[model samples]
Target: MIETPGILLTILSFMLVIGPLVFVHEMGHYLAGRIFGIKADAFAIGFGREIAGFTDRRGTRWKFGWLPLGGYVKFAGDMTPASEPSAEWLALPAEERQRTFQSKPVWQRAIVVAAGPVVNFVVAIVILAGFALAYGDVRMPPVIGATVPGSAAALAGLQQGDRVTALGGRSVETFDDMARYARIRAGERTRIDVLRDGRLVSRDVVIGTELQRDRFGNEYRIGRLGIAGGKPIVVRVGLLEAPAVAVKRTGEIVSMMVETLGQVISGRRSVKELGGPLSIAKVSGEQMSLGLDAYVFLIALVSINLGFINLLPVPMLDGGHLLFYAIEAVRRKPVGPDVQEWAYRGGLAAILALMLLVTFNDLGNFGLWKNLAGLIG
Candidate 1:
């Protein structure tokens, strides 16, 4: 079990990571509204009771809330932070209604809602690009520098300076290709073909195992080939190209998330694999212990995940609002107020259920259930 201080570290790390991201997300919405001349009523970080805050000259209440889980922006015509239309605000005079959010065109309203997630994505892309430009990336040829003594590669007669051509029947063109192929088959038997003295040689061996878990649910077998990689060439990404590289990397992460979700839906993966804030807190602590770089990367990753989740067309989320806007655009009228009310209610129930399930899974991961059982007995 983690000690009390370690637990405190985790809580602090979670706040450090989450607080700024939430601010950026809400700021995105607030700024977008400003761009279209809509006035905001409040700009909040977190939820629930007020912590420390002040009202801005624009009549916007800027405050931090006790609960620090998420945040929102209340626009002029909103009934609540959820952006529900206000009956009283709707009854205001024509001049007073001019700057309200609901008075904006459907397209403008959609942009305001989407700005939150878009800002999250932009933050990730900028951070990743900065890293690539500053630290460079691994892009080298596939050559073995040395094999670990008494290990699988050595036992299989592999030698230093050997160029790997293929692993497990897959072609290996770069060092990254070899690493990617081998990292998934730990402890499994595999064939490796190498180029030595301009001749081809093949060997069969069991890929060594090292279990790696980045988060609560994301695990990798991380096959250890027992051979050191050749000297990695430093490929300093140019400023002009860094953004493209960042975009590609971001796309890959999104693809992985999509694939994982598909697997869960298809029953190839369990619903328990889904994690929540508790799991995030735990992993945030772990990454902080590694180094600032690792923790910063985690922040970027979580930002992207936040963007993707908000883009999902589930009711009560930003995407759900976008979905309603899309329908309004097509039909040339807003969704009926009663229908929206019922839909939001259903959405709230669904979100609550998901949160409960994920929290239960997180507690199980922490062995809380086992601890409770022990005490009960």
Candidate 2:
């Protein structure tokens, strides 16, 4: 079992990870709604009971909620208590429905709904770029630092100080390239070109797999070449390069997100890999233990995940609303309320089921169930 400090660290990690991400996501909605001339009823950080609040001149109630899980922005005429109508609202007496959301154009509405995810993506990009610029990208160069004795590299006559020049005839520029090539060829012998003692040499090296574990007891299989590499060399960049770096980082993260989703859908990744609040809390705690930089990185990563997940065309999510907008745009009418309600219910059910499943996985992974079984035994 993890010690008390470890457990506490995990909890703090989740809060740090989820709080800022959720805040930024909700802020996107609030800001977009405001910009599009849609009156916001409330701009909230967190949910449930209001802990702190103040009404703006525009009549938008900005507040912090008691529960810190997530947040929402209530717009005027949103069909629910969450929004007020902009048209009918304005048609009313001067004092009556002054700032309703329904008065906004469809384009405005779409932008308001889309803003939440957009903001999250923007936050992710900024975080990634800022981190990259501040720290300089530390990547493993193709140079080998150490070779494991009696391992595949040793058996293949690969030695320390050898630089990986190419893999499978493809030139390797960085450690990431070499690692990716090796991972794809896991359990298979592959041709590797190395610069050894200033001479280019080719060798057939078989990648071996080993079981790796996290401090939290999570285990996974990783391909190993029994060679260690150096840390990333940080390079400072000017303002001009920052934006490009940010875009590239965002693209890389998006690619990773898509690939991970594909793996999960294809059953190459376990559904047990899905994490819920508990898992997030555990991670948050761990990140807190590692200090601020790691915690910030985790927050950025989770922000990206939240943005990506919400953009999925699943009902009851921001993406689901956007899907409805797309349909409405095509049909020149809004989706019927009955259909929307039913779809929302279905989405809710699916989300709840997923939550339960992920929570169960978290418990099992945390050894809570095992401990319970031991107690009974």
Best by lDDT: 1
> Candidate 2, residues 238-354: lDDT per residue as tens digits?
667877877776776776678667767887667877778887787777766767888788777888888888988888888888888788789888787778778888988999998
TM-score of candidate 2 to 2 decimals: 0.78
Error of 2 at 80 (Å): 3.8
Which lDDT value does model 1 have at 374? 100
Go through the candidates in order and give each one's C-alpha lDDT: 0.86, 0.76
- In lDDT terms, how accurate is model 1? 0.86
- Score candidate 1 by TM-score against the native: 0.78
Error of 1 at 44 (Å): 1.5
Candidate 1: Cα lDDT at 345: 85
**Model 1 weakest lDDT span, ten residues long:** 213-222
lDDT for 183 (candidate 2): 52
Off by over 4 Å in 2: 1-9, 81-99, 139-174, 177-208, 215-218, 223-234
